[model samples]
Target: MKLLKLVPDDTNIDFMKWRKIAFGISLALMIASVVLVGVRGLNFGVDFVGGQMIRVTFTQTAEAPVAKLRDTVGALGYGSPSIQRFGAPNEVSIRMRLPKEAEGQTGAAATMTNAIVGSIQKDYPGARVDGVDSVSGKVSDELFQKGTIALLAAMVAIAIYIWVRFEWQFGVGGLAALAHDVTLTFGFFALTQLEFDLNIIAALLTIIGYSLNDTIVVYDRIRENLKKYRKMEIGELINLSINETLSRTVMTSLTMVIVLVAMLLLGPETIFGFTAAMTLGIVVGTYSSIYWGAPILVWLKVGPDSFVPVGDKPGAPGRDREGYTR
Candidate 1:
């Protein structure tokens, strides 16, 4: 029986051939992402915005009346409520932001939850209250601040670690790729107006780790090849390293994407944004490892001589295009 190969062992695609174009597109997207975030902004959920969340199930209905429920809740003078089905079709989660004055009042959330639940139970009998949750304005403000700090801290720490593990240039390249992945994910949420919450934070952190792992793999190969082929041009050497790791990269990314896509289509609605962010991360992370991460080495002056000994150049060894000694 023969084994499968998504990328053949002898493959030598010139990934760097599109480095300029890729970076051009990346710059445009990053700038656009910033603009989108600034203009459209993120649609924060109850977790960060401090709100009353009520969960209920309509026992008699096959599907929750989303439109009617919206109208009913909207008329409550509680403003618009964010409602979405979670597990079963009859169940839904409703989130209502608290007013500034109401935030300081005790049992305010409970009062609002009771009112909404009462209205639903009266109009539609057999409505069962599942649970209620609340967060104070101060608490949500703290949460938002802490989440921001956590993301920034994680990215900076990853950059510092890469700098220590590899070189400053590699660290810069890795960090740039991370920023690109994260920023674009944020942009997607802003554009689509998905609920940005603690779950999305976890997804961002996961994406950082994923992008870093891919960067380290390609950088490690580049380092090894630099020492092995001391006479190879930096461009060709970087291209070789990327192509060498292309098979593993493609396999790992494909596997994750398949699982994530499945989750996105068939999984629960609560994790939809999480899955979407990861799906986008896998794609951008793989691309950065190839085009953005590896090619940046050339611009930063990394070459075959980078890993050479301090004293003297070693004897020139004749090597084939595949990086093997002749």
Candidate 2:
């Protein structure tokens, strides 16, 4: 029986033919993301912006709890605290910016938390604070620094791994693609004003891994093709490798996208930012793996010599004309 295929197995696509256009589009969007970030800035969550977050659970179901909670907190003169459903329908999370008077005051977060809870208790007899957490400006800054460091470290590690497994050219190409994916993902968040918290950072790391995996698959095929088709030009070899792996790449990306989209639509608002980031990452990662990664090899002047074993020149001693030892 013939197997059904989403993409033809013997497909021959000239992916590299549109490299210039892809690069231009990617560059334009990346620049726009940077501008957006600089101008409007990120909508950082309480975790990164030095604020208080209180999770509360009500004893009974409440109608329009988000609006109720928001109004309640706003009436308390807290400068319009953000209130939204935390996880379950009965649970709500309230976040408030640090008041100027509370800044650097000892036990300010705890004092503020108690005041908020006490005020809410008057309206809802059985409502109880599930959890309370606070981040000072210094701590928030430190967390932001650490998160940035972690992202950079992950990218560097990915580059090093690729360099070890393949040629330096391949390593550079893979890293470029990874960077491209990450930048575009960030661009999406900036454009949409999604919350940039630790969870989003986690999604960014996952994107790097996903894009790296895809690029490595294509690179492996390119390496194999280099050995098999020694006479093929580097450009032709790259095109062949990408075409050979296109089906697998498309299937993998499509599967991931389907799952992510389901999560985005069905998951709770708590993870909306994460799911959105991941969804964007998958699409960008797949594109970079195909267009950005392979084209870089050509620009770097990669050829058959890059893959051939050192000292295994053609017709050398026991080696045959194909550089194989007898």
Considering every candidate listed, which one attains the maximal lDDT? 1
Which pairs of residues clash in candidate 1, taking residues 3 or more apart in a chain or in different chains?
none
Candidate 2 lDDT over residue span 200-319, tens digit each: 989999989899989999999998887778789988889999999989998999999999999999875668899999999999899998889999999999887676555556655453
Residue-level lDDT of model 1, residues 89-125, one tens digit each, is: 9999988887657767888787888889889998889
TM-score of 2: 0.85
lDDT comparing candidate 1 with the true structure:
0.86
Per-model lDDT = 0.86, 0.83
TM-score of each: 0.81, 0.85
* lDDT of candidate model 2 versus the reference: 0.83
- Candidate 1, 259: how far from true, in Å? 1.2
Model 1, residue 115: C-alpha shift (Å): 3.4
CA RMSD per model (angstroms): 5.1, 3.8
